[model samples]
Every structure is written in C-alpha cells, then in structure tokens.
Target: MSTPLAAALEKALQGRVRRSVPVTDLHDDIIPCPAADLFSNDYLSLCTDTRLRQAFIDNISKEPLVFGTGGSRLLNGNASAHLEFEDRMKTFFGAPAALLFNSGYDANVAFWHSIPQTGDAVILDELIHASTRDGLMASRARTALYPFSHNSAASLRDTILHVLRAHPAIAAGKATAFIALEGLYSMDGDFAPLPEVVRLVEELLPAGCGHIVVDEAHSTAIYGAQGRGLVAALGLEDRIDTVLHTFGKARALTGAVLLCSPTVRKYIINYGRPFIYSTSISHSMMCALSTSFDYIESSAGEELISSLHHISRTFESKLIAALQYTPSHLLALPARSTPADFPSNVVSPIFPILTSYPIPLARFLRNLGYRTRPLPYPVVPRGQERVRIVMHARNTEEELDELIAHLLAWSLELQEEEKKEKEKEVLLATEEVATSKSEPAKDKALFTISLPGTALRIAVSVRSFV
Candidate 1:
C-alpha cells in the first residue's frame, strides 16, 4: 500500500520518526510529572516572571486591539507600532537599521536566500544552523558557498584564500565576501571566536568588501550590558556588518530582528521574499517584546543574568569533575567545553553533553524529575550525539546536586552491567574451547585465539588433511 512518496520518506527517515508531543500536561501548563524545567531555552526564566507579564498586559491594554495582521507588510500589515518597535530596537542595539521577521528562521532564510549575489561569495563555519544552509541552497550564489572547520582560524584563512583564488573579483573589491557565524552555537554550547574571525576577514578580503554577519539567536538578552549580545560584549559592534537577534529564547516571545546598515535594510525590504510574502508580527507580540526589552535593561534583569552565570558555572564545574573518570565512549565534553575557551565574562546557559547513550541517559534523568532531551544522529553528527541541558536563573544548588547524583548513579549502573556482560561472554568462550578440545582431531577442526585486554576466545575452524 506504499506510494512512491511514502516509500521515499520511509527510506530517508530509516526508522527515526519525529513527532510533536507536548511537554506540558493536558490539564496544566506546568511540565508533566512536575519535572524541573532544564530542557527548554528559557535561560533567564522570563516566561513566568509576574512583573514582565503584568507590564505586557499594561502595554497591550494601551494598544488598539488587533489579533492578527490583515495581510502582508507590503499590503495592510505595516503598522506604525511595527516601525516604532524597529526604531526602538535600532537605538537599543546601536545599529543603523532594524527589520522585523516572524522568527529567527525566517530572518536567516530571507537574508541568506536573497542577499549574496552571483559574483559574491559566502564563507561560513561548518556548524552553521540548518536555516542558513537552506537559504544558501535556494540562493543564486549557492555555488559560491564555502564552509571552513568549526571555530578554526587557520581553516577560515585557507577558505578565504581559496575563495579569493577562485573568485578574483572578491580580491579586487568588485565583489563582496560574507562570513557567517553564530554568536553562541545552540548544540555545542560554545562561543564563536569572533575577534579572531573578524581579524582574519579584514586581513584577507578587500578592505571594505568583507561582511561579517553574526546570528545572536542563542546569546540575545543574555550577554553584554542591557543584553546587547556578544559582539557588544567584546566591543566589536562597530566591526560586525550584520547581527540577527531572535526573541523566542530568553525574551519568552516570538519574532526576530535584523540589525544592519540602512542600505542593507532597504535591500532586504525589497528582495527578501519571506518578509515580502508573510504577514507581519502580531500587535500583542510587539507589546510583549517591548516589555521584555524593558525588563532586560532593568536592575532585576541584571540580577537574573548574574544568577544564570553563577548557576551555569556551578553546573559546568560539577559536570566536568563527574566526567573525569568516565570513558570517552560513554560520556565526554567537547574540546572547547572549558571556561577558559569562552568569553571571560560569559558562561553559556546551554550545554551539549556528549554520549552514545543519549536516549537512555535522558530517560533516566527524566524519570528522576530532571527533564532533558536527546539529540541523536542527523540532528547532530552520528558520533556527536548528546543530551542538551540548559540552566535557568531559577534552578538552585540543591536541584543541581540531585541531578548530578542521579547521573552518577546511572553511570555506575552502566559500568556494572558492562562488567556482567563481559563475564558472561568469557564463560561462553571457555565452554566452546572445552567442547572443541574433547572432539577427535579427524572429526573436529577448531582452534581458539586469545585477544588482548579480555579473557575471551575466538573460535576458528579448518578442514583436517587426510
């Protein structure tokens, strides 16, 4: 009964079926089983803050009531409120222009799919988000895309050199080179080497032709004064050409903004199809966004950011210490997992703890009331499967301690299971050896070979010569 399309999908998915299951209970808004909220992206725990919610309600009450934009922005969707928010974000982020999108994915797709021209080139990190890749694939300049090793300066330099050799116009300043990066990677939980990347692009590409674009989706409202992001934290806001900030994570709302030059803003307004064809953000969401920004800049927001950092550092230190005796094949951290590798003042809320047994580990933690999800192959690379864990301002020391204790218990249990399995295998091999030796040489053709590091035997059979 399988159609061609259905068969194709089955082959592609290979038994890995994804589904939409709500984490919350059917009757309640809280997470099911009353598990701790460590699996979501709400880093600052702003989603449940009563003050922010009250402020949003107040702002919504002042606005003219409208549930949805009637049409696309080019038609009847463009509101004065939208323009006002864009202006506010422009001034807040210290950018010349700002344009809103429905989500970060929309912004990335619109920007990457339409911006780079045929003569221009885009050199990106290998670990760039899938949205950016989809945009590049649909772009006219897709042929010119080049990916360098993740966070490797030398690889970036080589990629630039290759692009220059292949496209001489880029070297001559007749064409532009766009360097794409994420301020804080979602999966790896590591910061990009922005300073090093900026210097490399400036050194290699033509003086004014290299454009560095940073997507601050994960870092927005979590770093810098008033949550300006990592580019601002490093005092490199003036150097970066474009920055994308999404509000869904720490802001506890939807939509994103692209901060760029006035010229680039005008270009996207004209050429970006996602922006042109899609309805604008809702009126109430705009009010919520404003309230969120007001909170981020307030004194309470600063305290929340500090609390997030303190909790993150505590978790990282404890987890690293726990993994010290663990086998790399069982559990480990990425090479750049140490604090010294991150920005001096920033400790990311996201952690991608590597393990081949992600599903089992996540299930164990979830059963213990610490909710986490596994990222298996295809979401990440095969050997790099992990369980993504996030820290929030509200998570306390006692919670972390309990989670770690459960994790260690699981690890110990796994080790014990492995020991018993090996013993079983050794006993079976010994029985085989005994049986082989008892048989006559003419009737039996068997030999046992010992392998190093374990008391196990491999049986080989040979024909007896008459």
Candidate 2:
C-alpha cells in the first residue's frame, strides 16, 4: 500500500479492468461468442487477406532476413530495404519525405517530443488519439488543448484566437504554434473539418508562425481514388505540414510512416529519440510493408476500398432500419440520438453503435455469436461508451445480415422488458394515489419501489383510510 505501483495494481484488480485476450489462432467468422468484434480498427480485410500472404512470401524470397533489426538506423540496422520502403511511401503519400517508425505510438512520440522547440506551442484537438496526447505531454514545447466541437472549423478558429490571447507572452514572437488532429476520429468515425482548419492556419500564419499536422492512421489506404488517404482525397496534400500513417490498419501489416517536408524529416532523424535510440525496423518487415504498398498501387487496393464503402453503406442502411423495427413480435424501443449527421464525403470504414451501456451491448452481441469489443470509460470520456463496429471488404453480406438480425432480436427483448417495468411502475403509482385520496387526514410517507432486474423504479405514498 505504501508503494504507488502496488496501490495502482490493487486498484486495477479491484476495479475488474478487463485485459485484452491474445488470439493464438485465426478464424473466418466470429459468431456465437459472448461479444462481437465491432471494436477493431482494422478497416480493410487486408489483415487476413490471402494476397498479402503471397506478397509477404514474394518479398522474403527476393531478400531473406529474420525477425529482428540488429541496431538503430544510424547504426547497423539501417538497411537499404528500409530506405527503399520510405521512398516508396513518400511517393505513395505524395510527400517530399517519409520516415519509418516501429508503430504509430512510436512515431507520434518521436515527432511531438522532438520536432517542436521549447518556445513552440502545440494547439491540438481536445479529442485527439491518446498516443498523440502522450506525445504532446512528453514534448518540451508549451501545449494547449482546444475544443473544436468535433470538426467545426469555426470552433477551431475561435480556439486558436483564445490560445493566442491567453498566452500573450508567447504570442509576441516568443513562440510558434502548431495545430494537430486526426483526419478521421477513431471513436466517432467522423472526419475533421480539414478545409476550414487549414484556412484558419493559413490566416494565422500571415500574422505569426503556425503549422498543421494530421494523423492519417485511420484514413490511409482507404480513401481517395488511389487510396492515398483523406488529405490526398481532399487534395490538401500540399497544405498540411505533416501526416502520420500507420500500416497496421488499412495496410494490414506493421510499422508506420511520418510524411513531412524534407526539413522536418532531417530534424526528426537528427533529434527524434525513438528513431535514434531504438533499432530500426527489420529488413523483412520493411520488405513486407513495401510489398503491401505495391499491392495498394495495383488495381486490387482500389477495388477493395470501393468494396468496403459499399459494405459500410449497406450495413448502415440495414442497421438503421433494424433499429427502427420491432423484432420477435415485440414493440420497438426508442432510439438514442445519432452520433452525428453522416458526413457528405465519408472516407474511413469505421462506424459507431452508440449505447448507454456498451458492456451490456457487447455481452448481448457475444451471446448471439458476434465477437465485439466494448469501449468503456478512460479510452473515451465517461458517459460516452460505445460499440465501434468496423466493416471490412472481406466480410460476406450474409454475415452482416446475420449480425444485424441478432442485434434486432436483442433490442426487441430489451424493449419488452422495459415496457413491462414501466407498466408496473404506473400501477404502483396509481395504487399510491388511490390510497392517499381515501386517507386524506392521515399522515403519509413516500417509499421507493424497484422492479427487479429492470431499469424502472417508482415512489409510492401510503396512508391509513379514515
């Protein structure tokens, strides 16, 4: 108890914080489990695609290497294959330069901690990914979080003005400000107001120094005609200062890339600790990522994005309708507010199933043979727990239908139970009112009553009859 680590460990255990279960084997369909896998960030089926397997094999044949990188890039680990992969990524993402990282977390930490100077300011969205926040905290620069109302350019502009006004000491040529946000949010599955944010940054830059950075971790290899990501899709590749793309999601592989100007690349390579101290990515992983990029360049990647969009749209339509209808001959329940109006130009393949209690939803789905993950508090703020359903191109239409059907069935059952509980409450209230009227002269006290195992409670006043 005296030790901080021991206290924290005890709190975690007592809180029953769930641990992530590692999968030893793979399967095609995740059904009949206690929860469905609506929480994965894997937007493309590439994670399990057969073509990627062949691509990996082909790359390994061309140049044989093992699992580990012997040293850092500045040391013996700097392989020619890594250089070639970076070059290919630079071309793919249309950046002047690209640098590889062990993962998105490492990339963000390296960039945020080392890139900005001590006098610099980082104005980031309030809801940016946790990794970016951790990176910003580790940085030497002064940072401020600004609420942009979940993709409102007007809000961002106001936030920028507020930050400048509040930090007058830094405003007068003492510091520079950088704006950071994600192209697509992981939780809401919505995009940032890039055009407006970019415009505001440019307007501010004329008066003072300002820069913009975007984390394209969820947008890469899934948007635009060539799958170049949201920034490229919007034709704002030249407008943003830096873009971070991870290979784990859409690329269905490992590693990450930080796309920036040549100057920024040089600065990071010279100063970034994660890149300098740690061993570089292995030649094999580099080659695998290279081959994955090649596959993206081919027509198959385009087709896959298109297929993913179609599946996403289909799933959305079906689920919305199912939410509205009754299942199993029961009355339907009232729906909560939708997360946000669907963006006119959606890019990512993630969608949110907003629920009051995500754990119960996950449990219900799991009982029906769907493998879903529940996003509880801490990852998201308290009271915003949700089931994040991600669609992949490889998922069959039939599987989607079955998943929807089970959800509809569960909803209907819950509705029936809720209706019964409400009726019981009404009846109890009526009895209380009747008793009070008959015994108006007697003093009465109100007592609370609960309908067992249902989300309904009632208060009743009792009195003696005259």
Candidate 3:
C-alpha cells in the first residue's frame, strides 16, 4: 500500500502502481509461470543443469551436513570449503588472489567503503550501479559522479578532468583517484570504454594516483576465455585493478568473488567491514559454487556458452523486425550493436525497448503470457524508460517468434493510440481557433498601413473581412 507521503504519486496514476520495494521484475518462479521467459538472468540455464543437480545431491548427502556458517568469517564462520573454493578461483581466474563475499552487493559495498581513503576520490560513470554509490556514500572518501562517455575517449577524458578540477587533491597527486566501471552494464547492455579510460589514466593521471575497478557481474560466465568475462576476452587483465565477478547471472549461483592482489585480499579480510561482520557463506553453498566453476571448464559449459552466444546474435538479428522501429532511438539498434550508447559501446543478450507507452506494452505482454521488465521513471530517466528483454540460451526459436509477434502487435496498437491522442489535441486546438475566428467583430480598429512596394497609406477595418 502507498503511504500518506505517496499520496501525490498514488493519485497520479490509475494502473497497478503498488507502492513497494524494488525488484528487477525479471522472471517468476522456475516451476510454473504462465508467461514467456524473456527477462530472467539465468543466461546459460545452468540452474537446471543435470551435472549441477548431481553435485547438489552429492554435496547434500555428505555426512555432517552443515546448515550455517556459525558466525562471521573472522570469528567461527570460515570453512574448509570456502578456502578450497577461493584457491580454485585464484588458480582459475589467474588472479593473484581471490576472496569470496556473501553476495555481489556485499562485495561491492565492502570494496567501495574499505578502499578510497578520505583523501582519495571515486570517479564513476553517472550510470554506475546504485550499490557502488551507496558504498561510496558510507566511505569518508570524496566521491564524484561523472558524465557517461558513451564510448568516446575524448569525452571520458573531459569527464575525468572535471572530476580532477573538483577534487584538487587528486590533481595535486596528494590523493588517489579510482576509476569505476562495469564490464557489461546491465541496463544499457553495453561494454564500458575501459581501454580508452585506462589509457587516459595512464597518460594523464599523476603517479600513484589510483586503480581502475570493474564490475564484471553480468558478463561473467558468458564472455572471455573459459568464461572469465569481457575483460579477460579483451586481454585487459593487466589494466584493471580489482574485478568483481558475480555468480548470479550466467553461472546461476548466489554469491560473488573479488579478484585482486593478495595484499589487497588481506586488507579486505581485515578492513572490509562487510566481510568481517557478516556471516561467512555456508560450506554447502561454497561447495556448490566450486562445482559451478568446475562445470564452466567442461565441454558442456563451453557448448552452453557457444549456444548462448548464438542465441544472442540470432535474437539481435531479428530485433529490428520485431521492434518495427528506427535505429535512432535509445531502445532500437542493430544486431551485434557496437558503440553509441547515445554518444557508450554495448553488446549483450539484453535488449532495451524505449517506448512512449512502456507500462502499457509491458502490461499487454504480461496479459499475453510474456513476462517483460518495464523500466519506468525513477528507475530510469523520465523520457528514457524502457522494456528490457533478456535473451537466454535456454530460450527457443519459437519463443523468439512469440516475442516478436506480440511486440509487433503492441507497437501497432500503441501507434494507433498515439495517433488518436494527437488527433484529439489537434481538434481541441482547432475548436479554440474557430471560436476566436467566429467571434463576430467585437470592435473594429481602423489602421493606416503602408504596402511594401506601393508605399501607400490605406485605412482598413479588418473585422469586415472574412
């Protein structure tokens, strides 16, 4: 229910605007949802993998099954499974060390708060995930949100300069400046201008300035060699400082891993308040996460990745026909879309459908058994609200057909509705004009006017003329 404070908002809309906390509105239960699965993050459908299921059974049957972590890791929360998993990840990802966190949110929060000393500043893309901003807010470090580069190095440099100007300590080399970005941005489904930003940092930033941190959450388990993510795929392992890999997306798991230097790992273990204070992940969960990594290196995992990629490209190839739209708007784009996230570069299974009637389209699809994610105002900018459709490896061609057909129908209906709305406005304006035109001469004003070219003064009463 909406609170008394939400009265204006409640009255402003007539739809099912339930005042509630936010959820991605991705997909419903895996059991039975009477809708097309077009928005789930289970990209590779590994959640239902038989091997994973076997691992789950095998781990569950192990003697002395532990249900809890007992306490936080610093206390009695650490487990053998946790250590084993970390070691495997360290070796697997080729990082100096790997640290596990309860979840991506926890890892990011800890990193943002623990790093960046009071003198240091965090320079992030304006569209960086909210969790990062919240973490920075908790820190004593100076924070600056910069304009998105949209893949332009010059634009990124300008944004960094602006941040430096605002934080003189960073300019004077007294404080470190951390550049934050994502390997794959969730909303826009775009790749960050990482190389360019790193180049800028190398060329312009003062020595001992700071590090470039990245959230490879969405891209993990999808891109890169052995599914390390787009950063690894681009061979940018040396350029990035810290990388956050989430197991929630393509991996279909429930935790996160932070890849960084061993020194940084120790620092995080000690100073990362979130890790020290929160309950350590359970041994069972840790074991399950381990199995996931093992599966990623298997041939089945490789095949799944290939299939998912094929699905993404195939779906993208068909988006134009389904959207029935021009490639100029924020939502519409071509297959394998590269640069210009309005002037950022992006390529992913996510499709953002920008529309004037976003809520209606989402609702219509929902009624037709398609679960779509509608991004409304506040979630996105007012005019940039969109319907986000996530493509999955498990999704079939028939599902794509259904998605396209329904989307086309909705677009046509919206077009007609928009036309009618415009017609109504024009009619109202025409009526107002006609009323003024037919107002029978209230009073006539005679005026002496000189014609251009004739230069003759003429007295004329305009009221007498039609």
RMSD values, in order shown: 5.3, 5.3, 9.4
What order do you get sorting by TM-score, best first?
1, 2, 3
150-185 per-residue lDDT for model 2 (tens digits): 666677888778767876645675667788889888
| Candidate 1: residue 234 lDDT (0-100) | 80
| Poorly placed runs, candidate 2 (over 4 Å) | 1-8, 16-39, 142-147, 168-174, 325-345, 377-383, 427-466
lDDT of 1 by residue, 277-322 (tens): 9999888887888889999999989998989999999998988898
Clashing pairs in 1: none
Best by TM-score: 1
Once superposed on the true structure, which residue ranges of model 3 sit more than 4 Å away at CA? 1-32, 143-151, 163-174, 324-331, 334-347, 423-437, 440-466
Residue 327, candidate 1: alpha-carbon lDDT: 79
Model 2: how far residue 337 lies from native, Å: 14
Ranking by lDDT: 1, 3, 2
Q: How far is 55's C-alpha from truth in model 3 (Å)?
A: 3.1
Better of 2 and 3 by lDDT: 3
